[model samples]
Target: MGIIKLTNIRVYAYHGCLVEEGKIGSDYRVDVSVTANLQPSATSDHLKDTVDYVLVNQIVKEEMAIRSKLLEQVCKRIIKRIFNEIDIAEEASVEVSKINPPIGGNVEMVTIAMTLHRSDYSDPTQL
Candidate 1:
């Protein structure tokens, strides 16, 4: 019933439909929201009981850095990787945006989002 949000994580990478996009690169702003029971961390004041946001950021960054033509695919990769890799996160939503896309029109960015839940997920460490 509680949450910890990681927001405005800007990643500079090459991911677009155009060939120039993959060659020149662009900016991606991602917002990640993780939901989990934080009662243990709140009560014990221990970092171990909660998710480490730094690790999450690294994961997101790594996923975004991978060159992909579609933001939708990149967003899905982020969601699936978090669900399969991160253990402490019970639920997560990844919102990835393409800044100043080459649409040749008036548009700031295009957003692609995906949400995933690890309710029945197995621990990767154990596997």
Candidate 2:
């Protein structure tokens, strides 16, 4: 097993509970970690044998494009997509940060994180 990490993906998006937040949007940073079997890729050195980081980034970008009321929901969506679409992924962790949150006080950001294993995820097709 091996861990693949993609960190500090910056995006400007509109995701918040407040009305103004959605109109103005904010900067966000996303981090993703995936655990999978890497022996095949490690030896064969083929992109097809392992999780593709570029595809992961595209997924993140696509998810971020959708507006949501909460960071927790966004984080979950990313985790679920990675686990379901990436066949080699055994586990996935996602972190989302809203930079310079509008909390009335001096705050740099607010973040939400979630982790899930492939076995723990419900089959989407059954739903």
Candidate 3:
């Protein structure tokens, strides 16, 4: 198995419980990683045979654009989209970080991370 990682995807998005936060928005960083079989692509030298980072990046950007109250929600959407859009992906993990959150203390960032296996979605109760 091989992994494809897209890290430090920066975006400014409105995602928070506070009204001020929704209006003012916050800076966010997203990291996505996927595991898949790369041997086919390695031998064939073809993009179709492996998990594509471009699609992964696009999924992260699109999901981040949508406003959600929690980082976990955002991460779930990103993972779901990656699995739906990328057939070769066996597993996907997403980390969403809110930079300089409004937690009333000196904090660099708050991040929520989640991982999903392709089979996890088969039963909605697991979610």
Candidate 4:
């Protein structure tokens, strides 16, 4: 198995629980890391061996731009879409973070992350 990561992808969008948060919108950053079996690409030297990060970014941005009440739902939707859309990735680890969220505490950020693997594939972590 091999890994390809897209780090600190920035986006501006409306996502939050508060009326002001959803109404005004804010900056968000996503860190997406995907692991796929690399043997095919390594031997064939073909583009089919890996997921295209560029296309993945567009998918992520489109998902984030849509307003959602909770970050968890947003994260889940992205993961699901990735699994269905990106064929090269066998496993995915997605992190979506909001900067300076509208919270009472003095927190600087809040985020939701999920890891999904194709049910048919072997665990990449064991690789």
Best by lDDT: 2
Give TM-scores for every candidate, taking all chains together and pairing residue i with residue i: 0.88, 0.95, 0.94, 0.87
Candidate 3 local lDDT, residue 84: 77
Candidate 1, residue 19: Cα displacement in angstroms equals 0.8
How many angstroms is residue 84 displaced in model 3 relative to the true structure, after the best TM-score fit?
0.4
Q: By the lDDT metric, which is better: model 1 or model 2?
A: 2
Which one wins by lDDT: 1 or 3? 3
User: Candidate 1 — which pairs collide?
Assistant: none
Q: Cα lDDT of all candidates, in order?
A: 0.82, 0.91, 0.89, 0.82
Q: Show pairs that collide, candidate 3.
A: none
Q: Against the correct fold, how does model 1 do in TM-score?
A: 0.88
Residue pairs in collision within model 4: none
Candidate 1 per-residue lDDT over residues 1-127, each given as its tens digit: 5888899999899998789998999887999988888888899898888877887899889998899888888877776776666566788888999888889998898898878677644643321
Model 1 residue 66 lDDT score: 91
All candidates in order of lDDT, best leading: 2, 3, 1, 4
Q: Could you give the candidate ranking by TM-score, starting with the highest?
A: 2, 3, 1, 4
Best by TM-score: 2
* Candidate 4 local lDDT, residue 127: 21
Error (Å) of candidate 1 at residue 20 is: 0.8
